[model samples]
Target: MDHKQSQIQEAEHAKRSYGSLLNVISKQYGSRDTQYADFSGECYKAVLEECYKKAKIDPSEVCYVEADGCASMITDAMELNSISEVMCKNRKTPLPIGCIKSNIGHTEAASSLVSIAKAVIALRSGIIPPNMHYDSPNPNVPALLNGVLQVVTEPTPLTGNIVGVSSIGMSGTYCHAIIKQNPKVKPTKEPASPIDFPWLVPLSGRVELALNTVFEKIEAMPFDEEFIALAHSIFKTEIKQHLFRGYTLLNAGQQRVHEVKPYDGAEKRPIWFLFSGMGSQWTRMGVDLLRLPTFAKAIRLCHDVLLPKGVNLLEILYSDDPNVYASSILHSFVGIAAIQIGLVDVLKELGVEPDGLVGHSVGELGCAYADGCFTAEQMILSAYARGRASVEATLIKGMMAAYVLKDVINFLGLGYNQIKDQLPPEIEVACHNSEFSCTLSGPVEDMKKYIDTLKQKGIFAKLVNVANIAYHSKFIKPAAPALLKYLKQVIPEPKPRSKRWVSSSIPEALWDSELAKYSSAEYHTNNLLSSVLFEEASAHIPAKAIVIEIAPHGLLQSIVKKSLSKCTNIPLINRFEKDTLKHLFQAIGKMYLGGIDVNIGNLYPKVDYPVSRNVPALHNLLTWDNVKGELISSFMKNKKEGSVIHSWDFIKIYDKRIQNFLGYKINNMEVIPPTVHLVS
Candidate 1:
């Protein structure tokens, strides 16, 4: 490798070594200046002795010593010389001693660890560590002494636990650690309660304090059912707060309060319940809803509509059948079906109805059904037709995607206009997802080629994943004809408007009167093919309107939020799965009770969900407070065998506290800080 590459590799190796050591070392050792200190001969010997004891090895078995360092080369040499002197003078006879610094310039703090670690492995594997930079020893050390310690420029043989290492920090502290042959060790004992309640807060600043507080509480409190229940409640509240209002800590001594007085003049508008899309489903969805009589009743009503067409919607949804959800099409159908059914069931049970409703895409069908603009049969039939048409159209014609530049329309100005005219007549923009991103649908190969040409010109373009078929593109125009034909065959019926529903096909929200114009057979054919005027639609809405997305994925929510940020501050809601519903309810409840107030200590945790048993390790790692106590606890618990001994209960509390402070389960990466040392 070239010099620069070699340097980079060495640096990276050093970093990994440091990181591993930081993860395993005792917190006291890890936090001490010894990691970065300059060493005295005595300090070096003491460190080596500690390593030998920790590894359960006798010094007599150590046949060689190798040391390296950039900043403290002479100091390390003296230390190693002292080791040799101790061996001989104490009647242990003699051992070969060497230093890599005599060859390559010291690797600084990394040098000692690297050289010594290599020496340990050499002893275990029957090889020797090389001295790369050595030409001649310092004149201060006798030349005859060199004969006793071979100046090795090439690999040498080693055997058994025949290696010993010593490292000194620039600050006069030293460390020695031994590396031994791999040992057969038993697995760690499992915790009494395998599951741990980990915090999921997101703010970094508050994590430490939160964890500290939690650790103290957990340690003091008895582990009982009541305690667990309280823990669960606290966990749930915090999660809810974190999800709704991102994890944030209050500024020191800052306080703000709001006062409200009752208003008498105007009538309160009925609440408009917002439902979510997909991307929110988890296992055992709707189980909580089953507990609510109102929700159960609503599910029954949905069963009436969905079951007749050989769609056991609930069974299809709840069944642990992987095959059914293999594609976006099936996933979307199940997601939309479950949500719509759940919403209808919940509303019916509560006897609380919506004032208006709007679904982004497939959600629109649900809205139509809920609004009484179409019968459940008509809505499902329309949806099925739409779904089939979409799937087929996508299979035949391809899709288009663009990474828009800032001020997208202006950036593409002439280029976009020119492409629009030259493109296959079937292509059209489908969804404007973001200000700088849009999706297009048309010929597959043609779109690819078009994107490539743009990319060659330094314009960013790529296709959306999972959306292989273009829905809103002109290539699907032929499917429109089929849809039109299907719509004509279905008999129309006039129904009451139970709630207001918005149509993406039109700029204005659809009321009972507007339904008549779209009832015509021709409107379905043409309107279905045309792109929605989202910008115009956004402008016509109220600033504080609560816009709930009813699509399969929460993609529409993201789109609407990005597009309409300026016009309205509406809280967009998605009603996809049960967690989403819980979140939505929490949001609504908060808004109803009072506006959200973000106070650090006042924040509550979310309820705990039953996660897999395998999650505790990750959670512990992520949430563990890096405070001295917690760090020490973790080090003792997770260290290599014979490193340290600590109580299991203490470690568990420390782990939980760390999780609470971090506001999430710990990830493995979070367990060790960047400053940690991996090598002795």
Candidate 2:
């Protein structure tokens, strides 16, 4: 080890590579002359035997020996003789041998671990490099002359999976180990699929700045390298989920950050989905939501049902052509139904299923789908029929405008009742949306003039885009009979609705009437003609519910906030937002902030990995007392010392936190132990 006269120069002879450690054991033998340095060789032999037994390998299974050369003439020769002649006495041929000290020099205190690492590299590479500077055998060792042991003087093939290593500490402390290859090799993976969608990297800290620091750290990660693994690993770790949270959306090698928000919720509450009616569709609307497999599957299921009727829902929904993107009144109806159905399916698949459901106007079809009131077939067919009937009865032209009651009050100091009195004879209050909002319906000219009048007076109002057809008003009454007829053809009689469905059309007072079966064709016809009592139906939503809007745009977001101020409102999509995945996950992160367990695992693919049995589930959990100053002793099996108990009465012990033991409290204790000591 001292041959090179330089520590750095000596490391050149060592081989470095991956290794699988098997087992290690330590032995302490009381020396014969404890006052001096006399020791017995038999203790080391016993330790080597115990290590071989613990490794579940016989002495014959060891293909090579990692000699503790130490560059000592007497000790090296004696160790080799004991290993080959005494331990491996059954071997017929000389055993191959080498030492880590000969390559990396004597590392002194850390030499045991160094020897183990050396054996690991040899086992992994399946090759043992030559013993550095070795030429001839030492004549003092009888095993070398007798051909019982042979030093590895040249590069040799290291057969078998096992390698044995031995090293020594000062005095009589000896350690022996066996290291081998890992048994579980990774299986070959299948070809890649587009399973990696956007992931919400949840971040939290004790304070706002800490949250920002966490965001900065994640943003600086090498996401391109094993990104999915990175995402899943972050979830797998036992990091505390805190209230001050922020999230970054990861999708297709791009990321965007959502600013920090604090969660002050008492507990996770049930979720409710609010499906808004039309005025949110666009060409290529499904292009982004289709990225989710669950969403796409929902579309495919409904698409297949309609294909038999000369309608290709898939091609139409994803088509770039304005005229072909499910644009017809009938197909457009089906498209909206499909989008709502798909969004619901996607949310449920990610563990955010609704506890309550409500829909405005035709949005009821989605509510029915989730409530088991309609199948994929019944839902689309009904949409197609309703759309056809509505298109056929569009002779009377009308328009709609949404009004916020708070804005009306701010400008005109008026509520819905007062504002209705001022409206023209032809104008109608189509939807009493909430305590703070209502929608108006009338002839296009009248509606436009009324909206401009309101805007001129500093009131906030926006024309609802429904192609000059006012829903929930007399303008669409002519379509009632035909709509009922088509819906009857789809579901001939009244069908039971799931209790989860909360109708925006029928108020609770009418639940015991003929509209009890809300899924009936007659009920749908009434739904089209009657005003939407969304504010009245909002009473069905439980307190602290997370209300998610199932619409292309968050049309009912303001109304829901006004009606259910205690609930969290999450919009599934934005008509103007091109990055749908980012928008969707940020909403999910908001729900998470509201105490919803939005399944983190569902965002990525599942991977199979083998964890070592030795790894404790909670790494930081204390399983033993390590701070106690104590002595340990061992005896051979069946030896008389094994039955004997030696008790040394403790005189004194130091706790090292002595300086502050009895001091005034720094944090909690009023007084500390001045000097923690044991006196027995």
Candidate 3:
């Protein structure tokens, strides 16, 4: 009990204190037994179990599980209650397991990410990549040994759309993600239908050079049906900012890249709606747009309003017979009004509100309707009255022709005077369309004589296909009084709103009370014979304004472009395009690039279907600069990777084998480009 006994007791006390600290540390961090089990098994099990629970899907639905098999990472993942075993055990068809680590070696913390990426790629490509290096199953991993889960040693066809990816951390922190293939979410691709329209491909990059480079690469690539769809997918899901942009057109197996232009970061710009007039009307215009519910609804409402007036508008819109009542003044004006109004509805639904409106000839009626100067019924009634009166008043048959003069301003003054003196008395310059384009109207024979005389002098002049010669010329004078009388009966007084309406007849901007004068029958009648001041009206538009041609086919795009020069002009619809959906979405994409707000919910309506999640290759451009060169090189090195099935490939398969099922002939077969067909 002396000094030696005291020293021994002190040492024992120190040992006890140290041992207590060790026990506290172990308890705080988790038991060594549990940690080891987690790193090898239960951590992954909990992650996968929680993932499955949150996703509310059974393991049987999963086609495969991307496993964590890096070195000792496999030791814990192979435990009895691990994700693959628990998730796949009850299934009649057990889930297959794959390890990307086996192919490229364990990537450490990044290993899990690599595995997740591989799983995503596998799901998208519909090919289960082979799990390399495991000639024999690990004796310690019971799932592989007992056949509870199968490791995919060979490249296998993906059985279904859903896949589960698992990753384990060295510190017992594990994670699992569920990746599903939606039939509707797949990257945009060429549809089963044939290519019939020029598809606009929106292309952009963070910088001008980047955009140009991307465009050059795209241009050099072989053209295929997927080309347009690929461009669309990128524009829809990537390129959040449009600093520099250019778009290409895919037509007849050729891709043409437009000049790249820079976008000045959003200074709020006004949007101008350019309503095209009579010549814009075509047989079956808006026929394809009927597929859009909102557009069709608008057309139906308009048709209902015009039907009682005795114009079977739908007959011209939906009929396969292109000539059915298409050229009549009554049918043309009513049809034109109905379609333009429908376009306004569609544009509004997509959040595009115009700041100003302009119209050429009968297009002014649409502008009046859009500006709230008249109701839909009133607008149709006015158009009907105008059409009926014009037909009733025409004493002599006349025609209009487009004359591209060498000098527009001169033609408006001195040149027009000289031309007027030389031409027959009946001829008159009706419309000054652009700096160099104008419309010549007179008696059909006089107009023909003038056109022949102009051609003799080597002038760029051609006969315009127009049924109604009652626009902006004396030829329409006989109908003016009748139109005024009819308008007085229909719309007695115009209630003008504050919305801006640019009168192309005067080539001037007018709004609110100023538009009231046009409501009178006499004013409307006088307007029918006035010169179209299109250039002057265009000059008045704001420098930052984006001019949109709100018509079925963008017949006015070139006209607007010529008028605006450097300003951006977007065509709301493509006249030559058969797929109205593509054209509508492409226009929206172009709108987005121009800093326009888009209502995504309204753009894509609610639908119940499985969408494919396979996005196009251009989506890779989203992270183009961030991706490693080695990774790209390695990806390109795999010859079998080239053989992987893709959405485009599937489309080709459908074209060659599935399209003619049961030997039935499909009506209106879409023209398949030679490039896509030749690939097979």
Residue 306 in model 2: shift from native, Å?
2.1
lDDT values for all models: 0.44, 0.68, 0.63
Full candidate order by TM-score, most accurate first: 2, 3, 1
lDDT per residue as tens, model 3, 549-594: 8776687675566557766788877867756656766676677667
Off by over 4 Å in 2: 1-197, 203-215, 224-241, 251-259, 319-327, 405-415, 445-461, 492-495, 539-544, 561-566, 611-680
lDDT per residue for candidate 1 within 445-514, as digits (tens), equals: 7777777776777667645532455555555676776666666665354444342554555545443445
Clashing pairs in 2: 405-436, 661-672, 661-673, 661-674, 662-672, 662-673, 662-674
Window of ten residues with lowest summed lDDT in model 3: 18-27
RMSD of each: 23.0, 13.4, 18.6
Candidate 3: give its CA RMSD in angstroms. Answer: 18.6
Residue 500 of candidate 3: its Cα lDDT? 77
Writing each residue's lDDT as its tens digit, candidate 2 over 1-680 gives 11112122222231111334466788776565664333346777778878877777778777888877877676676577668654567876667888877777766656765776566556545677767877788888877877777778777888777777887655667677776643433223422434555657664444556666656655654443233333434432223434455666654354356578765433457889888887667677777877777778888998888888777888877778866523366666878888888887777766676789888888888888788778877888888887888888854778888886343244332335657789888888888776667888888888878888877876767777666687788788889889988889898755787778887788787787767656888877788898887777788898878899987678787667767889888898887776776687778777766666656656555543322211112212113347986673321222332232233444222655344444456457654332232221
Model 2: ten consecutive residues of lowest lDDT: 1-10
Worst 10 residues of 1 by lDDT: 18-27
lDDT computed for candidate 3: 0.63
- Give the better candidate number (1 or 2) by lDDT: 2
Q: Could you say which candidate leads in TM-score? A: 2
Clashes of 3: 20
